[model samples]
Target chain A: MTELVKVKNLHKSFGTLDVLKGINLTVEAGETVVLLGSSGSGKSTLLRCINFMETPTEGRVYLNGEAVGDDVNGKMRYKEADLCKLRSRIGMVFQHFNLFPHMSVLQNVMEGQITVLGRRQEEAKDKSMAQLQRVGLAEKASEYPSRLSGGQKQRVAIARALAMDPEVMLFDEVTSALDPELVGEVLKTMRQLAEEGMTMICVTHELGFAYHVANRVLFLNQGEIHEEGQPQALLKTPKTQRMREFLDGHALFKLPE
Target chain B: MEWNFAPVLGSMDILLLGLLNTLKVTGLALLFGVPLGLGLALSRLSQMRILSMVAAFIIEFFRTTPPLVQLFWFFFAFPILFGVNMTPFTTAIVTFSIQSSAFFAEIFRSGIQSIDKGQWEGSKAIGMTRNQTLRRVILPQAVKRMIPAFMERSIELLKTTTLVSTIAYTDLMYQANDIAQRTFRPLEVYTVIAVIYFLLIFVFSQLSIVVERRLAKSGEGTVH
Candidate 1:
């Protein structure tokens, strides 16, 4: 399989605190890689670094083999203009589902297409409608985001990202903030996208969704990939004490008797 | 002595003209000031050090100094510096616009900055550049938050137009002074002008409340 995303020796630090330390990763095209870690293990930071949302203090990122951020004097320097273009190819959905409160749900989905992609208004509307339909939110297009539940808002956010026609999607704890009952709808939408072969990197603690949808599970511990493998093997028989302990803490990680 | 508003009644035409001029100056100042302040606030919040510094200097200079002093300087000192004379009316517009802009800029900066950082991050995640994020997502919300502050500043600007009287610009207060001098009755003249100012300001304040309610009921910039 062709490698769609490659990170070499990624290191991110905020001030003196090291967040992601000397990491290397690769994801093939159409792969769904679920990053699992407890809080502050830097799963979110790693996901953010992939898109230059939080620029790595030291690293090289290759998206579809094209270098993201500039290689200047052996250091990465991203000009805002270049970053903006690069970001368009990689969609990200936030935990908060930060839809533009001033816009209707349809406008929220259409904004990026018209503004960044430079599509015509009519074409953008059509594409946005299709995306909204995919997420089962087409009927709510005219409603404001504030009028929707957390699940519906997240669906709209997903639709907004999908309308950009990005090559890869990064889901940052997409359903972590949702109510338990509302989580299933968002996960179902994500499952549909996965089935359609959309490349995805998800940072999430929902073992059920990860178990069902993830092609690979990457367990991060203390800013490093402590263990990683296919969902059935690695989760069923954790190779390391850290993984075992982590699984013990999250009872959902228990294998069937 | 006896009190009478007979002189104010006689000079109704001049007072009306002056009131019109006051409205003109206030309206023009608001039209120019609100946009200028938005620009200044953006500059102040910008990452570029030079833009932030320049905006800081301008905002502090205009905000700290008195509007009356600014009017006097624009009227008296500007001609000497530029080798061109300005009418008192022109001077009043320039001074108040600049001064009101400084105040409005503060309001706008706070309003924009107060927006949740997640909103900005959300726009960025959708691949919007900073300018697009601000224009489409941030400013539309910020502008709503700024309206009340804007209305307050406008009312202050309305009262401030009276200062133009010092330059003989013949605003409401200026015409009041003229009528007072003509009839030599300061008590009645000042009383009439005070009543007029109160009524005008009271009406505007009530109107602003109605506007605020409308904006709240129908979300700002929420179409369809």
Candidate 2:
């Protein structure tokens, strides 16, 4: 399998607080990597850095073997235009749906396609509709986000991101803000995407999703990867004490075999 | 002192002309100010330190100083300082345009800043350039929320345009002053002009209320 994303010595700092410390990772095409960590473990930051939403304080990110930013005198220098182009190829869904409130669902999905990709309006609308249909939100295309349920809004957000036809999708706790029952639909959509061979990196506390859908699971703790392996092994037999304790904290980690 | 609106009514043509001039200045100032305010707001919000500082400085300078002083400076002092002829009409337009723009800029900045940070992240994630994101995503939402504040500022601008009267511009107030002197009926003339101002401003307030209701009904301006 060809590597689609690579993170080498990735370090991120907010002022004096270091969030991500010397991390390296690689995801192959069609691979689904689930990131598991507690709050403040830098899971969201790591996902953000992958798309340059949060620039890494140190190190580099590569997509398809191409560096996201140019190296200048041992430091990464990014032009806005270049970063924008790179970001367009990496879809990200936020914890809060973040659908444009001013626009209807279809418009939200079509905005980036028409504006960023410069697709014709008619073409963008058709593509956006298809993405909405894939997420099972095609019927609600004409409705505003404020009128939709949390799950429906999230699905529209996912459609908005997917309308770009990105190479890899980054999900930053996409279901974290949903109602208990609403999370299932969103997870189902994500599972369908994974089944269809879309490369995905998800930061989630939902162990059930990680166990069932993920090809690999990485346990992150305090800015470092504490443990990582195939989901069946790592979720069941954590190598480190911290990973074991972390798993112990999550009661939902166990599922019927 | 007996009440006699005869003199005030006699100068109706001149007062109407003055009212028209008042609207002209207010409308022109709004035309120039809204776009200028948007520019200043964008500049102030820009990441470039110097540009934002410069924009901030301009906005503060115009907002802090009195509009009357600004009008006086533009009308009396500008011609001498800049070696250019200044007319009362042009002075009214220029002074209020930049002055109201300072206030409008703040309204615009607050409106734009009030949008959720997630909107910016979402737009960025989709690969939109900053300008594209702002024009497509941010401004469309911000403009709606700003309508009420914008209407308030516009009404303020209309009242502030009356300051042009001190410089001998024939606005509603100036014409009232002229009619009061000629007719020797200060009470009647001033009261008539006050009523006209009240009617004009009241109409605008009602219009703003209607627009706000429409926006609310349409499920907008509630994104926060």
Candidate 3:
């Protein structure tokens, strides 16, 4: 598989606090990589850096082998227009689902398609409806997000990203905000996407999902990846004491057989 | 003292004309002010330091100063300072439009800022340019929450328009003053004009309440 996303020694700092330091990763097309870490381990920041949502203080990100920002005097500088274009091809769903409140689900899904992709309205609507149907939310097309349950809003958010026809999808703890019962429906939709061969990078605490869906899992510690391997081996037999201690904390849920 | 309203009744046409003038100024000021306020709000929220500072200065200057003083400055001082002719009507429109816009800009800024940062991140994640996201997502949501505040500012602008009478503008207050002196019925004329102002303002307040309720029913201004 071709490397679709590559992070080269990426570093991000908010003032003096380093969120991500000396991180390197490579995600090939159709690979589902789950990021697992304790809070403040830089999992979400690493995902954000992929889309330039959080500009890296240093280093580079490559999509399909094309560097995202311009290399200027040994430092990366991004033009707004260039970053916008780059972001359009990389889909991301946030924890809050951030659907536009003024728009219906169908309109929310169609917005990026029409505005960013410059598709005709009719064509965009058709594409958006298909995505909604894919997420089993076709009936909710006309409903406002405020009227939907948490799971339904998340599904609509997923459809919104999918309608963009992105090369890769990044999910930043998309299920974290949902009520316990509502998480299954969102996970089911994500699993379906993985089975359909969409390249994905996910930052999640759902180890069951990692075991079931992720081809590989990366365990982060203090702004760096401390361990990486296939889910079955890495999760069950973590090589380091830090990974074991983290897993012990989440021992409540049984990993899927 | 015996009540006498016959003189006030005789000058109904003039009072009506003055009311019309008041409305004309209020309407024109809103038409100019709302858009100007939006411009100023956007500039103040802009990333450029110089642009935001300039916008903040304009908003602060007009908001801190008294509206009456602003009207007097435009009507009496502007023509001399600029060496141009200034009509009372023009002066009222210019002063009130900018003055009301300063207040409107604050309302708009707060409305826009009140939107969740997740909304911006969501829009950005979809690859929308900042302008596209603002025009499509942020402003639409922000404008809904701003309805009540906008109406309040508009009512304040309407009442402030009375200051134009001091410059010899033929507004309701000025006409009331004229009718009062001519007929020696200050009590009756002033009372009638006060009631007229109250009724007009009451209608606006009720209209805004209705709009706010309708917006609530439609599930707007509730999303974070």
Candidate 4:
């Protein structure tokens, strides 16, 4: 497998507090990698830095071997316009699907294509309808985002990103904001996308979904990788004490410990 | 006293001419005010510190001062200050536009700010430029929220066209004043003028309600 993304010594800080410290990672093309960490472990921050949503203070992130964060005077900086283009190449999906409220589902999806990519309306509308149908929401294309269910909104958001035809898709705790029942539908959509060989980096606490979908799981602890292995090896077998403790802690997520 | 409705009927031809003049002023004001108001709203919401601050000062000044005073200054005082010869009707339209824009700008800004932050973030993520996002995504939503307020202002502007008579412009109020002066029927003439104004404003308000319902039903479109 060829490397689709590469990061080296990634570090980011807000004021004096270090959020991401020395994170190094590489993902092969068409690979699905799940980042497993408790909240505030810098998993989401790492994803943001990948897309230049949160600029890394010191490090280099490469998309298709092109460095996104520039190395200058021992600090990495990104120009805003460059970041916009880089972000287009890297689509970041949010926990709460950020669909435009003032637009129809069709317009919301088509807007980027027409306005950014400068496609003609007919061409963009055709592609947008195709994507909406792919996500099982073609009938709802003329419907507003306010009327969609959380799952449907998320699917629309997913379709909106897909319309950009980005090289890498980032999911930041996508199901964390969904209802317990609704989570499965969105997960199913992601699972289908994964089956269709879309390169994805997902930061999620859903180990079951990760086990079912991710090609590999990267376990992070204290803002560093504690363990990394295949899903079967990571989930079903004995490994590091850190991994054991992490999985055992899932019992607290249960009613009876 | 018995009602003398015959005079009003006899003078309907003059009233129609005044009505036509009212439509012209109203049309010109809306055409000028909405776009000018949009620009003001954008500048006021601008990231630039000094420009937005100055815009805030202007909005506050116009909002606090009477539009009639502003019109007076534009007609009488500003000519000496600027040393330019502008027409009375032109001056009336310009002054009314400037006065109406402050309120319109504030309304637009509120409407824009009312939209979800998600729409903005979503727009950016989709690779749209800042200008494209504002034009396509932001303004459409803002304009929708602004329609009712826009209609209310249109009616206000419809009434404020009367102020044009002060500048010696040939609008509805000017015709009414002229007719009242010549006919020596202040009570009858002014009463007829009031009813004409009422009819225009009433028809306009009803039309606005219909547009509002259509927009609300269609889910999202242009401002009513």
Candidate 5:
């Protein structure tokens, strides 16, 4: 597979504190790479920077073999009209799902296709209904996100992003906010998406899902790459002392690889 | 230009004609005014500081001045200041609309800004432009959020109808004053006019509540 994204020495800070400092990583087409880190290690920021939702204080972000920006919101330099076109191949699903509360599940999913792609209302609705069916929520299309369970909302969110026909999906702790009982449903949907060969970068603490779904596991610590390898080796034989410390502290959960 | 309430009300034909004229001015003013107010509200939220400042200044200027004073300024002073004379009807509509727009703009601006920053980022990530989000996502949500305030503002605008009398416009209050002066029944005639104003505004308030309930029932996640 070809490399789809590359980050070099990315640094970001809010006020006096640094979140991501001198970080580097690469993602290839159709690859599901999970970033495993405790909170505040800048894993979420790294995901956000890739999508231009958060500007890196200093660094380069390359998507599809072109440097998108050095420091701008990174999204601003692209043709405003074509901005969503780029993101169509790369979707981001938040921890909360972030589905618009005022819209129905169908409208929430249909928004990008209709508003950004300029699909006709009927055409978008048809496509949205199909996407909902794929996620097994066709019956709930008319319902609001507030009425759905956490797993259902995340599934709806996954379908919403899928309606745009994106090749890569970013999951920022997609199941983090879910109840433990609800976690399995969202993970199951994600496992299904991964099996279909969609390139994804997920920031998650759920190492078991990461071990099963990810092609390569990246461990980030203090805004830098601590180590990375096939999931089993990273879990059983961490090469660095920092990776060891991370693994030692995380062993209690045995929840992450 | 003269304050002659005498014989104006006794001639029912003339009073009725004046009342008709009043509706024409008020109705047309509101028809276009509401949209303009929405536009002004959008301008107030523009990222450009100078644009927002100018919009804010315009709203504040109109909101602070007394409506009667603003009416005189638009009607009598504006023409000489700018070397143009406008009809009183034109002036009344212009002034009333301007007044209404300012309040509506501020009310709208506050409601729109209340949404979480996360919503904008979320919309942008999915590839919707600012305008698309506003129309498809933001404004629909904001409109429901603003229904109660909208009713309050409507009542204010209805009360403001009396200000047209200052410019010698023959609205309901103007007709009341005419009847009061003629029959020497200032208390009775004015009291009757107040009752009519109360009835009209009360009906409007009840209508908004019905609309609000319908909105809430439809899974809009709004109370007002």
Candidate 6:
């Protein structure tokens, strides 16, 4: 299987403080990689760097064998227009549902397609409706985002991303801001996408979802991959003391005997 | 001396004509200023060093000086400097548009800046270019917030037009002053002019509040 995303020697820093320090990783096509880490472990930063949302201080990121933020005449850069095109193919869902509050749910889904992909209005509408239906929000299309529940809004955000038919989707602690009761609906939508073979890199603390959905789980600590393996094995027997201690803090995960 | 109200009543037509000029000047200035203010505000926030500095300098210069002084300068000095003579009406319009645009630009900047940064990031994440993001996402929200401020500036612009009388422009104040000098009834002439200005401005202020309420009811201002 071809690697869908490749990160080589990725390092990100804000001023004097380092966020992602010389990290290297890859995601094969159709793979679901769950990134688990304590706060400040740079999981979000790593995800952001992949899209060049926060430009990596040093490193190269490749998506589908095409280099992103490439060096142009000794300067690391991607042209503004080119960067926008690259970003569209890699869908990102934030922890907070960043749906355009001024627009109705259907419009939010339709906007990127119409503006970026240059789809005809009718075609964009038809596709947006289909994606909204997939997320079970077709009825809420006419309503603005402020009117939706947190779970419903996040689902809409996912549908908005899905309408782009992105090659890969990145989830940044998408359920962290939701109440416990509201978390399941969002996870269910994500699970359906993973099942249908959408390549995904999720930064999440939802250990249960990570255990069930992820093909590989990389446990991050202090800007490095401290431990990684198949979820069943790693969660069952953590290889490092830090991983064990981190897993121990969340005693909620029941071991499957 | 028996107080006579006949002169004030007789010259009511001139004052009414002057009122029309005031309304005309205010309307024209708003038509010109609002869009120019938006452009100026955007330039002030632009990434280009020279453009932002130029915009900042112009905005600061206009905002700090009194409109009366600016009007006098434009009416008296500008023709001398540029070697092009303009009618007093055109001069008044030019002066007010420049002066009020600074106020409007500052208002626009505050309204635009008040929008949450997350809105900008979200639009960018969805693959919108900066201009597209601004046109589609930011301005729609900012424009709603700017209406009341725009109306407030319009009221100020209306009042400022009275200063044009200093340059012999035949606005309501000029007409009133002319009548007072002829009739020597300064108190009565000034009082009538003040009452008329109050009524006109009061109507606009009420209109502004109504529009603001409707916007609130339509759920435009509430951020998600």
Which pairs of residues collide in candidate 6? none
User: Candidate 2, TM-score vs. the true structure?
Assistant: 0.98
* DockQ list for all candidates: 0.77, 0.90, 0.88, 0.46, 0.55, 0.72
Instruction: Looking at model 1 chain A, report the run of 10 residues with the lowest lDDT sum.
Output: A248-257
Give the better candidate number (2 or 6) by TM-score. 2
lDDT of residue A90 for candidate 6? 88
Candidate 4 CAPRI-style tier: acceptable
Count of backbone clashes, every candidate in sequence: 0, 0, 0, 0, 2, 0
Question: Native contact fraction of candidate 5?
Answer: 0.63
Tell me the lDDT of model 6 at A122: 100
Retained native contacts per candidate, as fractions?
A: 0.71, 0.94, 0.88, 0.60, 0.63, 0.56
Evaluate residue B160 in candidate 6 and report its C-alpha lDDT on the 0 to 100 scale. 90
| DockQ-best of 1 and 4 | 1
Q: Order of candidates by DockQ, top first?
A: 2, 3, 1, 6, 5, 4
Give the per-residue lDDT digits (tens) of candidate 2, residues B129-186.
8899899999988988889889988999999988999999999999999999888899
User: Which clashing pairs does model 4 show?
Assistant: none
Model 2 score (lDDT): 0.93
Error of 5 at A220 (Å): 2.1
The docking quality of candidate 1, as DockQ, is: 0.77
How would the candidate models be sorted by lDDT, starting from the highest?
Answer: 3, 2, 1, 6, 4, 5
Task: Choose the strongest candidate by DockQ.
Answer: 2
Candidate 1 lDDT, B1-224, residue by residue in tens: 99887777888899899899999999999899988998999999999999999999999999999898899999999999999879998898899889999998999888888788999898888789999999888988988877877887899999999999999998999999999989998899889889999999999999988888787787653210
Place model 2 in a CAPRI quality band: high
Candidate 2 or 5, higher DockQ? 2
lDDT per residue (tens digit) for residues B1-224 in model 5: 33443444355565566557666776776776678789888988988899888889989998999988988999899999989877777888888888988988887887788776767877888888888888888888788778777777776777777788877778877877777777776766666667767777788889988877887787554422
Model 5: runs farther than 4 Å from truth?
Answer: A69-79, A120-123, A239-252, A255-257, B1-23, B213-224
lDDT of 4 by residue, B102-192 (tens): 8888888888887778667777776666677789888877777778778888888888888888887878888888887776677888898
By DockQ, the better pick of 3 and 5 is 3
Off by over 4 Å in 2: B216-224
